[model samples]
Structures are given as structure tokens and as C-alpha cells.
Target: NPRDYKSYKLLFGNEKFYDRSSNITLNYEYFYSCIDNMNISIDQLMSSIQKLQFMVVNLNSPDDDPQLIFESLNSTGVALTDADKIRNFLLMNENLPEQNKYFQNYWQPLEENTHFEVSKFFRYFLTIKNAQFPKISNVYDEFKTTYNNLDFDKQNLFEDINDFSNTYKMILECNTGTKKIDVILNRFLELNVTVIRPFIMAIINDFVSNKIVEEEAIKIVELVEKYIARRIITKTPSNALNKVIATLYRDFRQFQDKHNNQYKDSEVIIFLLLKKQGSGRVPTDEELIRNFKHNDWYNINSSYRSYIFERLENHNHIESLSIYEGLKNKDYSIEHIMPQKLSSDWKNELGNNYQRIHENYVNSLGNLTITGYNSKYSNRSFQDKQNMEKGFKESHFVNLNKLPARSDKWGEAEIIERTNQLITSALEIWDFPESTIHEMIEEKEMYIYDGNETFSNYKIHGFTFINDEYIPVKTWKGLFVELFKLLAKIDLNPLIECTKIDTKIGFESAIFSEKTDDTE
Candidate 1:
């Protein structure tokens, strides 16, 4: 039980009570039993056991790579693991005094904080900073090499590692102050994604450095939660998520042109996310609504679907249900409105379209909800469930679910309508705020045309800005046509399409590069 005094329990059988008296009593009984069974003297048995000596192998080589030597020695037979190797490698190069200092300061604190999960934490840290997952055994080698390439010297390196470990622990524990972010992180944790950690770590740095306000930080983290959740719901290629989030710090840097820093981090993150058009696209409300209608609620990971249920059930309700609370207590379970095992009454309620309704709506969002009576009322007809103990009407989700708003019969039409309603609510819950839209500037397409001027005195005059810089069109008509042909592909947007301007020829440096060709 998580709420137990230990938050965990260890049971003892009293058989291994290792007191001196018990030890002697057990040994004497063993010796007496041996003597009775085999006619062996107690003294001889004791002497034989005492004569056995244990051999210890200590491997040391200043010339060899300690890691290689460790791997060579530690096989299936030994207790040495990747974590042990990492600890040894990190400490091996330090002087005696330095080694003890580092161990007492950086290493011990992390070990205590992570509950001796130091190796796993180190791998997570490496993955976050490097954007690539490391093999467990190679983590120390990767860390050693990668740390050398970084800007920090040895002293700063340890300090940076310690600082990052603290952030990792905060995120891993979901101890981030705000309730909303903490809840969202709990959902993320349940989704079994540690890939988002690198991105979160970067954001936490931004928070610590005052690059973004706390509210904006929350918005960014929440958007990522929705981004991953929607991808899971739509069954998109999740391998793309790691790549997207891994390079998030790089993605954030792309916005560092002059006015970029003036924008709120929420705006920057949301715009960058919206601009992702391929597999990385944060799905639009239309896409979400469409997918939610058809998504198989049962086939989805229970944790993910449970998160969706919690969001649905808690919307507009003051007393929120914690997913953690549910885990620690018998609180809620996902209940299918249209039972998985259909009764005669359910078939009749769905009418002659029973198979169609069953196939489409059985595991769908419209027909599923959070319920306290899942085990008790499961598989009953909707009407029977409505009448059962702690039934649908009493469920906390009833207000949000609005079950009876449609039809008492709960058929295909009602299911479709409810699917639409729930999806709209989902959009409201997970949607990125619309106020951030103004932060993005859409690149408008531009077109260039030869101005109507006499054959001799012709000039490129599309706007006053361009016409104003009247470099007379003469032999350069060939130049402009060549330039226009080089630049134009039907319509060209200066921001989006101008690949490069050949600046060696002075005409290529013409003001037209910055000007919009306003004329048709």
C-alpha cells in the first residue's frame, strides 16, 4: 500500500532472525542433525567448514582502459553492473582527496535523492543533453567523451552535473509547484515517456535563468503534454516524438533573430509547434475531433486513456480527482456505456444496426466514461446500469458526460452526437491558446513582373519602394529577365522562396530583393 507507514512493506519470516543465540542454536542443531544422519563428529564438521577459504580478485591496471578491464572481468558471474562501472570510471582519475570530496558532495547526494537509482539517472541525463539514447553499458564512456567536448573544465563539469541532477529529480518526482503542471506531468509519467525529459530540462533551465516566466513555462509543458497525447491518440509514428523533443533546444534557438526574444515563450513554443507540418504536427482541433470519434479507447494504453478520462470528468468541476489519488485509492475505472458483452436489451436498444453500433461505438470516446460502478454495473443494459447502485446518474462525470441529453436508448445516432460533443470538449481542454497566434508572421508569397516602360527607358517599378530606386533598364533588360527568371517560379515569396541573390553582379544586390512586386 502506497499510504502504508513505509509507503512499502517488507515481510520477514522470523526464520532468519540472525541473533547470536539463534545463530548458535541453529548451528548446533545442524551439527547434531549431521552427526545423527552421517555419524560425523561435531568438531570434524566444524573444522571442515572453517578450513574453506574465499579468494578475492582485485583488478588494477594504470595502462588499460578501466572500463574495458571492468567489462572483461564482470560477466554474468559477477555483481558488477553498468552503474558500478560508471561510478568507478568517474572516480578513478581523481586524486585520493578529490575522489573522497567528489563522492561525499556530488555523488552521494544524487545517490540519496534518487534512492540509489544513480546509474539510471545518469543515463537519462546523458540522453537529455545529447538527444540520443545511450546503451546502458556505454553510458560512462559516452559521458566521459561527451563531457570532454563541452565548454566546462573538470570542476565545472561536476557542478553542472549536480545542478542538472537536481532538476531531473524535481521533474521525475513531479514536484513542480503548480498543480496543473504537476498533474500534466503525472499524465506524462504514466504515458511512460522519459524522452520529454530533455525538453523539460531545457525549459527548466530557461525558468531558472529567467528566460521565461513561470506561467509561460507551464504553458510550454502543457502544450507538450497535449502534443504527445494527441499523437498517441491518433497513432502517429512515435519515433518522431523523440527526434522532435530531443532537438527542442535547437528548435528554440531558431527563434533567436532580433524580435524573437521579445515574444513570450508560450507564443514561441506554440508557434514552433503549430509550424510542424509533417509527423511532428501538433494535431489541429479538426484532426483531434475526427480522430477522437473513431479512436479505439480499449486498445489505447490504459494510462493514456485514463488521463483523457480524468480531463473529461474533471472539467468545470471544483473538486478535482487526482490520477495519483485514484492509483492509491479505489476511485475510478473506465466504464463503457455500450457494454462490450451485449445483452438482448442492448441489441434491441441499438436496434437492427446492433453490429454496426457495436463495432463502431463499443470502445469509442462517445460511449466510454469514468465510473465508480464499473465492476458492479459492467455489461448491463444502459437502462439497467442507470438503475444500479452508485449508478450513471451518481457518477461524477455525469454532468460533463451529459448522458441523458441525447436519447434514453443510447443508439448509433446518440453515440455519434456524444462523440462530437466529447471531442469538442477535448479540444477546449488540450487546445493551445489562441492568443499566441499574433506572435507568428506568415510568409506571404510575392511575384515579379517587368514594368511597362518604353523599350529604351524601361525600369522595374512594382512598388514606390522599387520604382523609387529607378536604375534605368537598358542592356540590363537581359540582366533583369535573367534575374527574374532565376528568381521567379510563377509567384515567389521574398521571405519563403528567395534562396540566394547573386551579389557579385551589382544588379543582384538590387533593392528588389527586399521589395514586394506589387503589380499584377
Candidate 2:
């Protein structure tokens, strides 16, 4: 237990898990299973394994980073995971009593709750605590580098991580216990939106600590739900989600600071989320409608279709199919009313516009549905396909599939009709909650004045210039012009004399006309 993660889990695992991989059975059972597969006697296998040599690495000074030692020994092909390296760094140097104490109190529970995904837990922890995202490949190094410079309480850091990991597991495993929250969590997992975990962890921590009420926590999570779903539905660039989510913990705290911490937690989250514009913006209803009609969503993404069908299928009911459970993800498949690989029968149904129709609707909402019998009755003529078992007519997913089933013939007209029907239902499913959105404050464009102010040369927003670097009456424009004039005697102007302009903030367009001591 005072050793590495493999042994720590075995000793403190309550007989629930075995070495390194956290297998639930005993370590001997695993070795026996390997022996059974190899068809070798246990005695001979033990003899051969005993002959294999291993090295025990020691650090002469506690000042030596175990991380360096790990890298040196890892060349022997027994490399540790990022999770293992982090735990080793955390516990390797601690004294014996505290070592086992932290292991039993924190590390053991972390492994059990996260199902041994301690690396992912650490990633989310770092993202929230650091107010920025870290590369998963160097999680241990980033954590180590940041901590050495940060003025934080070390024991408090460990305890906070211990607490946050509990809620983190709830979010990751979708076992948050509150039905409303779990539904949102499951939807996030279904969409493969793990990037939001760090932000959600902050929210859940606040809720668990009673910094905010349960209602407020649910509202914030729901806002995150809308923010992500709208982006997916509108086919927004996927790269932006990581940056937006990474700094949300930072943004939320800044909001509280600016507002004197008086604003409702939910409102601050909603306002900041709605504040995201350009690529990071939550797509509006009109944009969602346009994107739904024209976007080649099927080709762009397949998971959303299943998510869409699953939600819309149960939209009306008080209780219906749960995608989190085995019902939807397991039983239903993304069925294409018009198959992606074209067939003659489906082509005739499309009529003269077969190529055009198929191209437009191949992966769109109108063409796709969640069905049980996808392979059994795929790409056949509509009447024949509908009459078969698990037909669209009998399909429980109604909004998209049922419309196509009811249509007399499948063609361009039918596809357009079905897309419109889907749009009507989808509007309610991914709708951004109505909020009094804060208007974005525009930057004031104040022209710099160079009239009748005598001053010694000074740094203009940190761009230092000497006394009278330009003519005494000077503004930023004139400052640039004066420098350009001096450099014009050559064909190539490689050396720059003045600092590049600071465009966004604290631009003091100044003058040296008023010369005085302490002129600022």
C-alpha cells in the first residue's frame, strides 16, 4: 500500500480490484487465465516468469523528481500511464503514515468511483483549477510545473480534488442521482461532449457545497446543454468548444466579481454563454432552422441523429424511453429511409431527380430514423419495406420516420416534407432558454489628441519612447509616420523603431506639448 498504484489498489481495494488494470478478480485468477490460454503448467510458467528480470529504481535524494526516474526505467517497456505517473509523484515522496493515509482516504475512492480512469479525472481537475486546458499527454508535467509556481495550500489542493472527484464521477458515469441532472449528463455523454466536464464539475461542486441551490445548478447545466446542442445542430466548428469550455470556470468567477456576487448563478452562466458570439455563439432559432434545412447533417455527424430521434420519440410523454439506459442506444439504430448506398428501387422512388434528391437527403434528418430492424428492411421499395417487420409505419420514433411512412411515395417532395416536419419538433428539443440577454458593450473609439500638452516622452500603454522621439506635437499616427519617414532612405526596412500598436486596450494617444515633472 505504501508502494505504487498497482499495489495500493490491491491492498486497499477491499478485495474488489486487482493490480495495475484494476481487474475485479484476484491477481492469481488473471495469471491462471493466461496459463490456461497458453496451455502450460503453472509450475513451468512460474519458473519462466521467475527467470524474467526486473529492476527496482531508487532516488538518492528526495529532491530528485520521481518523474525523471520513471522515464529512465520506462525504457524497459513497463511504462506507466499518465494516471500512474501522477499518483506516483503525489505519493512517492510522502512519509509512510501520510502516504497510506492519503491513499486510503483519497486515491482509493478516486479509483473506485472513476472506474480506474484517474487520468481523465486529473485532466478535468487541472482544467477547472488552472482556469485553462492542459494537454492530456503531459498531465503530470503540467500539474507539477503549475504547482511549483502557484501559491496554493497543498493539503487543501488534495482535499478539494478529493471532493471534486466525487461529483466528477457522478458526471462522468451519469450517476448524479437527480433525474433532471442525469438526463442532461447522459445527453452530454451521448453527444461525446466530455470537454464540458471541467466546467460542470465546478457547477456540481458549488451545488454539493450549497453555494447555489439545486434549481440553480440544474439551470446552469441545462444552459450548457443548449450551448452544445445548438453548435452540433448548426454544424459549428468543433475546435471552438474546447476553448469555450476550458475558460468557463474563469468566466463564471469573473462574472461574480464584476456583479458583486449578487447576480443569480444561473443568470450569470446563461448571460456568459449567450455572450459567446461568432463561432462560439449559441445558434439562434432562425439559424437552427436554416441549418436543419440545408446542412448535410447525416454526412457531417451520425451521433446527433440518434440523439435527435431518441429525444423527439419521447418528447410528448411524461416518461418514455431513456437513452441513458439500454433502451435507445442499444435497441434503436440510425435507419435511413433512403439508404446511403443507392439501389434501383429507391432510385425509381426518387424519379427523375434521383441523383439530386439522394445527394441532398442522404444523411439529413428526413432520410434517417432510429429503428430496431435496420438491416432486415433496408433500401427496399417503400410499400414493400413498410409491410415488412419493424417497418417505419410501426416505428416508435415518430417525428421523422412516421411522416415518411405515411407518405404515398418517397421522393424529393416527400424528403422536403419530412425535413420540415422534423424542424418543427427539433425547435422544441434544442431550444435555448429565453433570457434577457445582456447586450455586448462595444469598445469606445476615442481619437487621440495632440493639442497643447507639454510632457516628457513616456510609455504610451507600455510602448516606451524617448523625449521628443517624434515632433513635440505628436499622436500615435504621427509617431508611426515619423518612423516611416526615417526608414524610407533604403529599399528594405527591416529594423522597427516603434512598438507595434496595442489595438485593444489602454491606447493613450498622447502629446508632449505640455512639459512638466510627473506628466502622465
Candidate 3:
């Protein structure tokens, strides 16, 4: 029996019996014979013994032996096929009555302790192993339960599980034959379902970062859809998930540079719409359809269009204006002031490149405004539209001009100038004083001197100045107070120089008492 043990140990490269092998030929023959006689396959037996040895080493002294075992297993050039069999065998053995007490005394406490870095992975592996191979449904249930029990505000429950699951999947796929069992187990313990979105994001980010699977971005979109659906139904939607999806879609569109493509534009538009709307409720199908039709959102990707409308509806941003009397009424549309097919005369006057300029500026609602009389001036030019409504009676629902006209031919420079003008107009409309307005065209020159002698002179161009000054005077405190009150209205500082002056007055008085005494 000892000789048989020696032969077996030699074949398996058992460290304890290294000296037992003197002849390579004899060792090899003995190893093959043992494999044939035991009616066990060489691969199977080696795997079994390896796993047993690994478990024994770690169980004997986990603090030290686990690391050593990991190194040995990793260095042995063991086949993943064999490693997997050994792992399965050990996992099965964990449930044995004899091993239960050992696990409770050693592994259980380690798994439960949060301070240990490996505890999470260790516990997860044990749980999964004990449960056997779980179906997706079972996994989902486990995730839901785990999520329900967590305190989200205190712990970032989503990020942790997402990382673990991704790592776990990678390990399962790679099968590198390294027995980092403790690491694997720790990951399993830390995992929960809340991490699904983050895991998807990580995968998408990795793909994008590596540029390995550019086409796989579609898969990310599908995953996002699933995540959104699940969260909406479960009422546990993550704001982080929403923001990530929005940002990812935006980046993807930018990478594609599909500016003219309706699909790309729709995706960006939808993302913006959803972001504008706050979270919680999901939009109804009818509401989505209505908004899309009313806004002329056709020729765009249907799914993306619906998503934006839905998000807006969810936040109550798309509700009827009549519902809230006090709130200002707002309606959304895509207004084209210069109709797409312009007349030859207008185009010639505007410039031969008018189509491009018009598309750049006149197509969007930002360049348009809400007016009650949509039918009367749907596609009129600025001048014509103004003339048509000049004598129109004022009513509560009267059509007001939406956007100021482009004074010159529509071009890049003209568009930029008009945009700036509109912004300034908006500021003024909001009660900004003319003096306080920042003038981009003007330059201010300042002269500074030391002891009234000029020392430095410079001009600060394209910057606005704010004047803050007070008067200093003696015996004119009342005047200073009045000056300040007046200065508040005028935004310029008052320049004052102090000077002293004296005045004399002549008067006559009678003094006869002293003179009369001298005479007496």
C-alpha cells in the first residue's frame, strides 16, 4: 500500500513524496499501471487528487496555505478541464455532514466577516455551489430578494454586484486553470441584481474604449431597453442608469457623426426630452403617439421618438395647458419659417447657399415661438407675417411673433448674430437694465497715475465694467446721502474733488456803556 501510494504520488507530482521517484521509466510505467488498475481515467484521477490536495492545504491553514495552493495550481500547467472537475467535486463535498462542522467553524465565519476583502467572493461561491446551477429565473429571484433587503442610500448596492457578475462571467469564459477559489467566492458574495445597469455600462464602455466591437453598441442599446423595461415595471428605476444611457447614446451618435440621418437626430432629441422630464412614472402609449403627431416628429426612428414623448409625459411636462390656469402655457413644435422649397427669387436674394443656411437656422422651434394663430402664419416670412397680423385684434389667444427675423441673408455669421441678439433680447425681457448689459463691441480705456502723475494707460476691450463708488466730503453728509440715492439710478461713478473756501460779512452795533463811564 505504501509503495502504491508512493507510485501514485510520483505520477501526480505530490510535493511530499518528491524523493520517492528515482527512475523516470519506472515512475511513468507505475503511474500508467495505477491508472489502468483503478479503472479510473488518468485525467479524472489527477483532477480529483489535485482538488483534494488543494482543499486539504487550504482547510489545514487557510491564512497561509490558500495563497500557496493558488500559486501551485496556477504554476502546474493544469488543464482547465481537470480543474473544473476538481472544483465540482469539492463543491459537492462541501454539503457532506462530516464537512459541515469544519465549514461552520472555519469558512462560515470568514465568509460572514465584512472586514475581510475575500469574504464576499468566498460566500458567493459557496452559496452558488450549494444551490447548484441556478437558472436565469432563479438568479433573477435571488437578485430581487437581495435588492429589496439592501439600504440603497447607505450602500452602493448596484455597482458592487455589477462588477462581481462581470468578473464572474469573464472567469467562467476564460477558464485559465488558476484556482483563485477564494477570489471567485468573494465576488459571488458581493454580487446582487442592483448592479445590472452598471455591468451593462461597463461592458459598453469597455467595447467603446477598446474599439474592439464597434457594432456591438447595438447590443448595449438592447440591454438598456431591457433594463429600462424591468426598472419601470419593478418601480426601482435608477437615475444613474438613465443618465448613463443618455450619455452613451449621445456619444455613440457623435462617433457615428450621422448628423443628417433622422435616426441619429431622433435618438439625441429623445434623450434630451427624457432628461428634461424628471423620473418615476412611465408615459402612456396614447400620450406618446399624440405628442409625436402634434410635433411633426415623423421620419424619425419611432422607438426613440416614443421614448422622448413618454418621458415628457411621465414628468407631467406634456399635460394640457387648461389643467393649470396659473402656470404659463407652453407648446412644442418644429417650425420652419423658410419653407424647405424656397422660391427662386427669395433664394437668389438670400444667396445661392440659402438652402443650407435656412436648414441650419429656420428649421428648429428654438428659432420659432408659440402663437395662438398657427394657421394664419404657419410659413410666412418675417416681414410678410408682421404685415398680415398688423391690424389683427388683440385677444387672449392672439398669435405673437415667436422669433426675431434674421435681418440679413441667412448664413452662419447671420445665424450667430441673430442668436446673440435673441439672447440679449431675452435678458432684456427679463428686466435686465440697459446700462448693466455687457457690450461685446465696445472697449474701455483706463488711465492710472501715482500721486496724480500718469503711470499706466491701457484699454480693456470686450469686457463689461461694474461701477461701485461713494462720495467723501466733510460738512456735506446730507449731500453725500442724496448723491448715493441718485447714483443708484445712474450706473456711472461720480467724480468729485474737495476744496475749502471762507466768506466774511459786515454789520453795525451800538456800544455807549463803556464810553459814558470814562467821561464821568
lDDT of 1: 0.67
List pairs with backbone clashes in candidate 1. 446-492
Writing each residue's lDDT as its tens digit, candidate 1 over 1-520 gives 1112121122122444333333344565586676779866779888988999996655565565655665666755866755667677777767889887887788777666565677777776776677666766677778777876888676777787787777777777877676777777777777777778778877876676677678988888888887887787676666456556765665575675556577777777777777664566676677787789777887777767777777777776688766446744657666778888888888887789899879878998888876666466687877767766667666556554576433577878777887877887788777765545555455421112224323344333322122123333334434465446545664567724444754544445443456523221
TM-score ranking of the models: 2, 1, 3
lDDT string for model 3 (320-405, tens) is 22211211232333233454556665476568677776665553322333333454455555445344543123212222222233
Answer with 2 or 3, whichever has the higher lDDT: 2
Q: So what's the TM-score on candidate 1?
A: 0.70
Q: How many clashes (backbone N, Cα, C below 3 Å) per candidate?
A: 1, 7, 9
Pairwise TM-score winner, candidates 2 and 3 = 2
TM-score of each: 0.70, 0.73, 0.22
Worst 10 residues of 1 by lDDT: 1-10
RMSD from true fold, candidate 3: 28.6
Report every candidate's CA lDDT: 0.67, 0.71, 0.36
- What is the Å distance of residue 439 in model 3 from its true position? 38
Q: Which stretches of candidate 1 lie over 4 Å from their true place?
A: 1-71, 75-80, 135-137, 257-260, 327-330, 405-407, 433-520
Question: How do the residues 1-520 of candidate 2 rate in per-residue lDDT, one tens digit apiece?
Answer: 4335455547555655445443433465676677788967769887998999987766788588876676667747766777777777778777888888888888888887777788888888888877767876778888787768767766777788788889888887787667889888988888887889999999888888888789988988888887788887777776556667887878788878876888788888777777665466788999899988887765655467656667777776676765435334465566677887778877776788889888878877666666667565676777865766778778655654677668778777777888887888888877776556464545321122333333346433222122113243334445544544555545234433223554332212332333333333
* Model 3 segments more than 4 A misplaced: 1-144, 147-332, 359-369, 375-377, 390-414, 421-520
